[model samples]
Target: MILQLKEVNGMEEGERTALLAIAMNLVIFGIKYVSASATGSIALKAEAFHTLADFVASLTVFTGLKIAKRKTKSFPYGLYKIENLMSVIISLVILYTGYEIILDVINTDLTELRNSGFAIFSLLIATFLTFWFSNYERKIGHKINSPILLADSSHIRIDVLSNLIVLLVVVASLFGFHFDKIAALIVVIFIVKTGIQILMDGIRVLLDASVDYETLSKVEKIILDTPQIIKLKTLTGRNSGRYKFIEADIVLKTHNLDRAHFIAERVERITKEEIKNIDQVQIHYEPLQKEEIIYVLPLTEDKTSISPHFGEAPCFMLVTFKSGTETASKTEILTNPYANIQKGKGILAAELIVKNMVDFVLVKNGFESKGPHYVFSDANIELV
Candidate 1:
């Protein structure tokens, strides 16, 4: 099952990144707030609020990590959508703060942060730290394939750009140009743009849109390279947190229904192996047009059980359904190769049956799942 796919320590790594961001934001917040107070600069004050927003955004990402991994009775699928929800929350905060900065700048008396050496020095240090932190988180985000981490890092980059704008306000003030209001407006505009991008990213995931084009194309290529696939009917994917969920419909080249199912299983396994962070994949398949085939069964030594246990059966009994009826025309017995497998008896039995092109295996207890059932179903074989 694709749901079984996992990356070791992915969540741990994401939480570490988010926590680091939180610490960075706090450090920058104190530095910039002091800088804003000393210089009487509206632009620097806006940067302080921007850092505060970063702090909140970091908390949201950390919370998303916690919720994404948890599944409860009321939330059996886990809380992965919390990532999108957190992103939207972060975006709105950024947007609202940016608007506040714009109005504050437009109304404030235009002046350069005069003789504010400590303020400029502090802003520079915060800028360099924000830049480094954003870069670090971005690298880790890509490594873990964490959308929330990536989005949060982008949000931090907005801080870096805002710092640069504040520096521009300082330079313009020295020249008596007094472009502080205009420079702060530019920084707010950049913040709003980053917020919009973050919002779109979250909305796309919330809407269950198809996954990234590159990944979707990779999945398509892998399926086409599979040996027995006749036609790819549909290949679709979506995301929740760091994981991708895929569903595909395929047609098999073989006329035998059993053969078609075998192909679907192969596709599922290979795709999951090649693609990291795929938490689930469901395959719907069809066989190429073909003639009707035999009805297969398992039998005991005495051939007395129409309901013989497949694991203990000594031989297989093949029969044909009477035309347009549930009745069998006759029974023919063949040796069972997997009656005494040391391990994986069901799997070995299923493989043997599929190789012989058997259509069905009947069992009194219904069917064993995973190994044998997965095998049988993959080959379009059935148990009754």
Candidate 2:
């Protein structure tokens, strides 16, 4: 049950974060666009395009998550990784946008910088908001283990750095060195760096990389805590942007097949509950021996008092024969020999098979009359 909730919560958090990014980017884009057009600043223009890139990336995230939530006949394994693919696409788009901004800055001619003072205040506000959004998105990304959100955070982080660059340009313009083109070149580097990082992360997930160490350790701890589980042999996990799949092998000290199955299932259930991000768990069972098997041999009724030819008794068996033969015409014997038998039955020899030395007290003084009769009858010798 907790497993089910964790899966749902992870998805919900990812969707919420994507939506928040889209909304924030849209607002930031509008502010930067207006300021850039008013001031004729190349840095502001590039910053505007950067915010626009974020807006599109956020929209891509929203659509990818929506598609990923859906199940299809063709894709039985839900579309969780679609978001990762989209992040890669968005990264490329951001990179292209950055390149275009650089080319435009290099080609354009700046006649005058208008309303530079107002643009400075706007860039400062944008920087503060970009930092806030980046940190928030990163927090949610770690909580949900979302690749898309992490990618978005990386882009916003670039915006914060670019805004700081633009701030420096505004300050320079106030006191000499009003080189708008130089600031624009710096913004290009900023966007390119962000795009490269985002792309790398998305590609890693698309290639089906395993979840990190912290999550794996959490899962291992859960399996170890399950009742009746003696040891955990192996645990493996992989991530698909928002979903996690884990497989584990466990060893149990149960020879009984039923008990082993029950313990394995419990381990799987506990693992899913204890770990927050796992969507599916597969468990393999290994049976371990409690102790080595000890063999015992049956004995005839008359020879019950005598020890077996092999050694001390680990167990004993009782055999019944057809009528009319003192030598027991037909042989029927019990292999599992830890059983008690009564006297007055057809007298035969009883053999006790043993692992080590063992002693048993005679009951009712009947052993004294039974004597140490070792009847070597011609019968089949079966061990228990």
Candidate 3:
């Protein structure tokens, strides 16, 4: 079930942070608007409008988080893109806030500041609150990997810087100098810069851009490390909101349909375990086609005679031949490195054979209920 606004304790971390930002912005907007009216400072009025924009942006983020959780019949994949859409809207709001500041700087006449002490004190309080909340919100945004929250946090950071500039102007007015218009123009630069960054990030996700290269590399390593996978045909990942969707095509060593499916499931499970925020993992697997067959036989110390004991054998002989023909095309003898091991010798020997890509094991007797038997069985290697 989706979390509702009424359930405060059960709400997602992103929703909680967004709601906090809305409340904080509202309070700051009131303080700035009061200070602007009392002092008649243009920069203070511009900051008041910017704080109001922040309030609207935070509301948009909260709404997006709520809607993104719903999975309708038309949107089987969920409305994850709503978060990115909200980010775009927030960016536009920030940009418009900057434009308004620029207009105020150009059109408003220079007015002597009144109640300078009150304006400076109020701006200091607003700046301190903005700085604290922006940092706190950003920490939660990264922890939950929420795109809208991160975008909103960045917008709040711009407020912190702008408030500081306006405070400096208010203090300078006490010295018979007024640079309120110049300070507001500087604040606009920061606002525009932040807006563009958020806009680009939102657009990329909305366009179905691939996930970062580092994440893709980590996934590739995980897939390649699986012993049953013969080759990885394709691997691709993309981001929807803050979650990742991964798809891969692989070739397995086993020809059995059930074994192929089992290997695919194992790969999917491991991939999800190793990666964070994975929404879905789709793995398409096929069996490897055999053009040649390899056989491994346990050998005695002399290397010429077959050993009846599979685990205690000192060496192993590998013979390779075309699938249809009986005559061997290549033969090699390999030392059994695990022959002297006191424990798990049979299992280690079986793993060595699997690593050599042996299709069959030639043995003198049955090895039922043995560790080696299960190992070879899992690899789909036949006993002859």
| Model 2: residues with Cα > 4 Å off, grouped in runs | 224-233, 289-384
Q: Quick one: RMSD of model 2?
A: 13.2
Q: Which candidate wins on TM-score?
A: 3
User: What tens-digit string does per-residue lDDT give for candidate 2 at 1-384?
Assistant: 655677677778888889999999999999999999998888888889888988998999888877877778998878888978988988998899889888888788975678888898888888899999999999988887777778888888988888988888878887767778888888888778878888887898888888889988988887765534556888888887677888888876555677677766776677666666666788888865433222223343554553433222322433233333345333323343433344422122232211121122222223323322221111111122
Stretch of 10 with least lDDT, candidate 3: 1-10
lDDT per residue for candidate 1 within 124-192, as digits (tens), equals: 899899999999999998988888888888888888888888887776666666666777888888988
* Worst ten in a row by lDDT for model 2: 374-383
Clashes of each: 3, 12, 0
What overall lDDT goes with each candidate model?
Answer: 0.79, 0.70, 0.89
Q: Candidate 3 lDDT, tens digit per residue, 45-119? A: 999999999999999999999998778999998888899999999999999999999999889999999999999
- At residue 353, candidate 3 shows an lDDT of 88
TM-score: model 1 vs. ground truth = 0.72
The CA root-mean-square deviation of candidate 3, after full C-alpha superposition on the true structure, stands at 3.2
